[model samples]
Target: MVTTGDAAPDFTAPLANGDIEAFTLSDRLDDEAPVVLAFFPGAFTSVCTSEMCAFQDRLAAFNDLDATVYGVSRDSPFTLNEFREQNDLEFGLLSDYNKEVTDDYGIAMDFADLGVHGVSKRSVFVVDGDGRIAYSWVSDDPGVEPDYDEIEAAVEDLS
Candidate 1:
């Protein structure tokens, strides 16, 4: 898996912020702000919803640290937009519908019991201005959540 000090793999995916738009990770890197990529298996699920809402609750803290945060999932842009609206998420949600980004990041997983496959694991990667990952967290258990305090500290360090 990608870890601290490793260069983050840049990707372009459909980003939903009440609208569908192309989001390029490298483009966001130009401003020298830390980028938080929170990967979840799917949108609108209980755990995913809680995780996204938690991030939304702490969004101002991330913004104060000049961090750009995005929630990623295999859901389509349409589903993501509706999820954002329902959750009142302030940050953008990226649609990794093809699962390329999730696979590239080495966080892809399967829900074999449900006959679902190629979804993202619950993970979080904090990339600093240098495009290097500053913090990494991955959980095989979908119910688990990342340490929000740790992520905030990671972004603060980058600033």
Candidate 2:
């Protein structure tokens, strides 16, 4: 996975916002808001749900820190669309079906044991406007969640 101070890899992926449009990582960073790019393994799973919802729950705080959240998964946009609605997720859930984005970010993992291939590792990256990763946390265990406070403080420190 990407590490702090590394240049964040750029890619576009289908959005789960029902618009049939793609989300470009660099574009979000250009908005002058630090981008909180989160890569979860899949949608609709218990651990994934809690992770996404935790971001949703603290979205306002992230916004307050001048950050925007985006959750990436290997699931299709169709699947993520429903997952977002079902969980009341207000942020965008990106579709990295081919795992290109995940791979570019160096977070792709072989989960053959779990019956999933090329799934993304549960990772979080805080990218500043310059496209540099200000903070990064990649969990080796799917059940582990990143420290939300540290993520928030990292972005807040960007100013």
How does each model score on lDDT?
0.92, 0.89
* Count of residue pairs whose backbone atoms collide, per candidate: 0, 0
Those runs of model 1 whose alpha carbons end farther than 4 Å from true positions after fitting are none
Could you estimate the TM-score for every candidate?
0.98, 0.95
Question: Candidate 1 residues 1-159, lDDT tens each?
Answer: 798889999999999988899998988897736999999998889999999999999999999988999999999999999999988898999999998899899998898999999899999999888788999999989999999999999999876
| TM-score for candidate 2, residues paired by index | 0.95
Candidate 2, 49-137: lDDT as tens digits: 99999999999999787788989999999999999999999988899998899888888787787777889999999899999999999
